[model samples]
Target chain A: MNTALCMLAAANPVGHVTDKPINGQWYVSNVTVMLVLSGIATLWLLIPAAKRITTGKSGSIDDLRTRGVLANMVESVCLYLRDEVFRPVLGDETDRYVPVLWSFFWFILISNLLGLVPILDITAALGLNDFHGTPVGIGGTATQSIWVTGTLAVIAFVFINGTAIIKDPIGFLKHLTAGAPVFMWPIMVPVELIGMIVKPVALALRLFANMTGGHIIVATLLGFVVSLSTALGGVSGHGLAIVPLIGTIVIYFLEIMVAFIQAYIFTFLTCLFLGQLVVHAHDDHEHDESHGGEHAAAH
Target chain B: MQAMRFHLALVYTALLAGPAAAAEGANPFVGTIYQAIAAAVVFVTVMVVLKKAAWGKILQGLQDRENRIKHDLDQAEASAKQAEKTLAEYQKLLANAQEEARSMMESCRADAKKVSAELKDQAQTEIDQARQRATEEIQWAKENAVNEVHAQAAELATNVAGKILRRQINAQDQQQFVNEALAELGKGLN
Candidate 1:
């Protein structure tokens, strides 16, 4: 029963030894390792695709052709993100931000997918849970950790607010007051301010919660099989374990879908939030104002 | 103002940390600021590397393909227009040839009619000249025959008178007979 509880606790961020500080101000957690691995994995796949794309002569027939299925698949995803996802929201500025968004997408996706594998359980079974009393096994989803998601959200927050301010300082300041009259500034300012902070907090929590929650459910379901077996104290309990095992299998498939969904949601929402910050040209605003006036006059 | 906002955010984060830590027994809600810094570093590094390495290339390839497609379409349109123009020119040339052929055929028909009329007039003139020549020749032949016959007749008459005189006939009688005969001959010649 204690072992089952311990395994269930492993689903929590606090249960991992890497979350603790190894030295002063330096901590090496499972998430840190996963981040590095995700980065390496990203490089491994994309570098070859890049080579395939770049090595071809421009304007050649081969340039029009994709290198292979993997390369083509990667390119298709990139094109879809740029054209369908990013362009509609970011407009002309889509190109400038694609690299960052793509990096985030690939990183989060790989991290989520890697978490689905039972590497940590295998390592634990092998008695390699700690390396010389330091938690250094291959396991845990980086995106599941609040710190990782918080970091990503912070970065997005900075990009959104920073770009908004840089693009139009006066407009940004004005936007904060929600375009309200002088009388409403007091109420609107705090609301806008809170809204600004909330965007990043929401981004962080959404990813962290989805990932952590799915993992907790999966671990808990599997723990039921162990607890049932222990309760029966014989082959009878082992036979009953099939029920929870089936349930765990179903949840496992759900977790896979959840992983992809959460990554997409995070990226899509970031694009939406970033899109909001981009200021249209002044001419458009004047056109809108005139149109609004005409509409009011007609009314 | 920015610094004050930053401090306020930090205080807010600290205030939230206590409850978050107490809730999950290990506080999954509040992460160390260092983790956020590490993530930032990792993400930035990944972004920079990817931008330099792969993303730029892929985008360039896509752009190149787009431009190529545009250029090919433009060329195809131009060629189609050229073909249409060529077809129009050929059609015009064909129309001109047909018109010229029609005019040429009409002119040839008119020339044939004129030539046939000229040939008929020439044949009629030759026939008339041949008839006139035939008539002149018949008149000459008749004159010759008549002269010969008159000469023969005069000679025969003189001879007859001489015989009669020789037999003792009167000279005045012979002379009257000759004169009558000569007068009859002259009427016949007329």
Candidate 2:
């Protein structure tokens, strides 16, 4: 068999086929399909949901407030991400960046959820890998790919830094000084620069590591069932297979939770990083004063 | 045979993965730059498209609804306060009307009592006057009857005297006889 053919021939119980070099060229992969699919899925769910969440042309607030579960869930998550997550850090500037942050959340979350769906595995089961003697791998976890996650981090980094520069160029420059004394500027600035680069790198690694680790674990456990049952070859083979099967099931459910959590962590950290740039010291002071008054009143 | 075939394939796949994954680098974390570029394009497209499609409308709606709810609560509170004030005013008016009616009733009763007392005094005076007049008329009628009887007795005595004498006596003697007869009638009336 050809090396390129072997790349696509490998099934899910074996490994991720996208990891191989089919033709070893810069071409679209399963990750690309997942990217496009996740985008479409996000749009499909939200486009209609947005209409329900929006106040009707009748100008009735009840229309917005009294919506169905999908609308309510979307609205609540958006609100929690904005008011609880973004507003605390971004302050009044929260609204300006809510679109980007919300996009990050929904896109990443949907992508994460899509990864849990075994599209490629199902395709392999259907024996659709060969297309007229050509091997085509059509599914994989997009976020599990380092390139995909790196791309997301770079986008986040650009938005975070771009807003910082545009919003307050002076403060953004001062941030490079790392709030150290004049004499310490040389060392602190370089350190700050590296830290800035490291922030997005960490984001990329975190998402990639989380998705890759969990999905690979589930696949490996399920692969054990296949390997063990075939190797053992009898009632004991099937009976021993139950252990890895149960393990796969358990990890599969855990992957679902990890999917949501990783999405939240990625978006939250991005928001926090953006806040560090866009929001200022004075803004924090003002926020503290206002919230302090609110806390006192509440008590 | 099947078991051997399956395990052999796993080994086969593992062998195949090593070389291809190492094509870029010995490091597994090494990325394909072009893949990143493609992903960047896709993510940007998704984010930009969704920002327009959904985020703007949802945020604006929440803000507008909050403002409207605050406005509605204020209007409701104002309306409730106005109703309370109007109710108090009406209650005061009602109390004043009740007081006025009670005072009027009291005054009417007082005036009736005063008129009734005055009428009773006037009737009493009229009855006293009628009784006095009746007593005076009875006394005057008794005196008139006594005077008539005295004149009749005197006239009888004069005629009797004239018969006994069968002639004309001295005028002084006749008159003396009649005077004696009037004195005797007055004594008898007393």
Question: Which one wins on TM-score?
Answer: 2
Worst 10 residues of 2 chain A by lDDT: A5-14
Listed in order, each prediction's TM-score against the native is: 0.66, 0.67
lDDT of 2: 0.75
Against the true structure, candidate 2 reaches a TM-score of: 0.67
Which digits, one per residue and each the tens of the lDDT, describe model 1 over residues B69-155? 899999999999999999999999999999999999999998999898999888888888889888888898887787667656765
The sequence of per-residue lDDT tens digits that candidate 2 reaches over residues B31-139 is 4776688688878887777778888888887777766878889999999999999999999999999999999989998988888888888877877787778778877
Give interface RMSD for all predictions.
Answer: 12.9, 5.2
Q: Which digits, one per residue and each the tens of the lDDT, describe model 2 over residues A1-299?
A: 36424432332432552343334454555676788898889898887888888887665546657378998899889989888988887888888899888998888889899988888768657765443455555676778888889889999999999989988899999888856799999998998798788878888888988888787677666655765565455786688679879988999889999898888888988887787777776455554464344334223
Q: Which stretches of candidate 1 lie over 4 Å from their true place?
A: A1-26, A129-137, A233-236, A281-299, B1-27, B77-190
| Interface DockQ of each model | 0.16, 0.18
Position A243, candidate 2: lDDT: 88
